[model samples]
Target: MSELPMTVRVDGLPDRVTIYEVGPRDGLQNEKTVVPVEVKAEFVRRLVAAGLPVVEATSFVHPRWVPQLADAAELMTALGEEGRHLPVLVPNERGLDRALELGLEHVAIFGSATETFATKNLNRTFDEQFAMFEPTVARAREAGMDVRAYVSMCFGDPWEGAVPVDQVVTAGTRLLDLGAGQLSLGDTIGVATAGHVRALVAAFGDAGVGTDRLAMHFHDTYGQALANTFSALQAGITTFDASAGGLGGCPYAKSATGNLATEDLVWMLDGLGIEHGVDLGAVVATSTWMAGHLGRPSPSAVVRALAG
Candidate 1:
């Protein structure tokens, strides 16, 4: 039997999609142990060499908040010249300054769609969170950098239960208004069904947030990430956030699990004949290598099958 999926062209889906790889940053933030900066650097290199178009390198968040990525500066140094092109997560103006000092051109900020999450993760009230992001986004744009906003917990929140579609759109559009070129709608708890996914995207569209400005970030907590991704694609979404070897989850949200695995997403995109510009065999090898260092089996079904 062949490892590739039979190509069956699907209508309404874009001819080519961009897979935003988050394994280095989002993937390792939750690790119980601090991954060496050298290993993190190599992980990013392997993924980039594997044909991933965009690899989010690391976050400049406080080391006390995410100790796994405490060596963000060192990791950037390890990446050297290439680091300037890769996007890094920066929590505030201070974080943005760190990225700027390193000559990075791309940065992303994390925002919450619900009050509870804002309080828990950001330690700010819902309204106050925007105030915190405004300056960071403004300065990043002023510095000629591309700003990507992540509206996390868009689908559901563990403390607040199911979130309203309108609420998420409001937060997302506001971030876009704040000079974010793109927004990644995050299903932090992975409780969203396909209908919920389509509805949320539609709500954003109704609010004048075009499909071009939106990307989907799904968790596999409820095993609904792939199905929800299909829903987003059916709704004309072309950008997806995935982690290689199924690494990543919300460090603040205990209910969250690994992100949609890049290998698995590639497998589906390949089967669907979507041009994501990723090499499945190369991705599997990279994830397999990273998994070896992590000392754990990959949660990705495709990696387990192909790398076994």
Candidate 2:
């Protein structure tokens, strides 16, 4: 049997990268079954114990919109101190208020790079979406919270064909200008290629947005996530958004599949000798345990390989 790969250095790649774990929030958001609040909290604990520096806890989005996370308040209450440091998704001022009431300090805002996605997902025009985010971000910043802006559909939109790189840069810059400490570029549909990833990062670089202020979130729908990640590494990106066991996808965009698997990503980084501070065996065990709750096997190839 093939064992875990030996670490090998890759030039131009950062010595260590931050693996932003999104399992609790993005991973469980689209679950058909409402994962128990305790189970979700335990998931966070397990991820933390596995050395994931950042684990997105849950979203404060309205229950009607995302029923899977309806127990956001209860989850936060259950997590208490552990939850405070974790970032939660706040769709608007109301969501932010919920987070604030729970004493959470870090938050994330979701934005769309295309007009159709903005309209379909957020119920606002692409141009009007920023206005909605403005108040929430301002309030969060006023409260001394770090805000992350997620620009979805960065590569291509289901409703709109190819999203212009310039348009994505424009939207990303606008969100950055709105007090977001970092911007996560998302391939919501998982249709991006390595070339597209380079072009977009280069465009952002030209716009004066350094790679440090950027993160990449890709799905495995088209199986290009790993390639895209390598491209981002070549572009000097140090932060990546991944979900444990390849859980979750875009609920608003039906075409999207699971996110880039955290275990799979860690495996690649391990082979590349990139220090991403995660225990792959622990993550695999965690995902295996969680998968039992979800009533299916993990979609992550590394999980299947290692768990087997």
For model 2, residues 211-287, the per-residue Cα lDDT tens digits are 99999999999899999999999999999999999999988989999999999999999999999889999999999
**Backbone collisions counted per model:** 0, 0
Off by over 4 Å in 1: none
CA lDDT, every model vs. true structure: 0.93, 0.95
What value does the lDDT take at residue 266 in candidate 2?
96
> What is the C-alpha local distance difference test score of candidate 1?
0.93
Where does model 2 exceed 4 Å of error?
none
TM-score of each: 0.99, 0.99
Top candidate when judged by lDDT against the true structure: 2
Which tens-of-lDDT digit does each residue in 1-308 have in candidate 1? 58898999888888889999999999999988677888899999999998999999999999999999889998998899999999999999899999999999999999999999999889998889999999999999999999999999998999989898899998998899999999999999889899999999999889888899999999999999999999999999999999999998989999899999999999999989999889899999999988888889899999999888
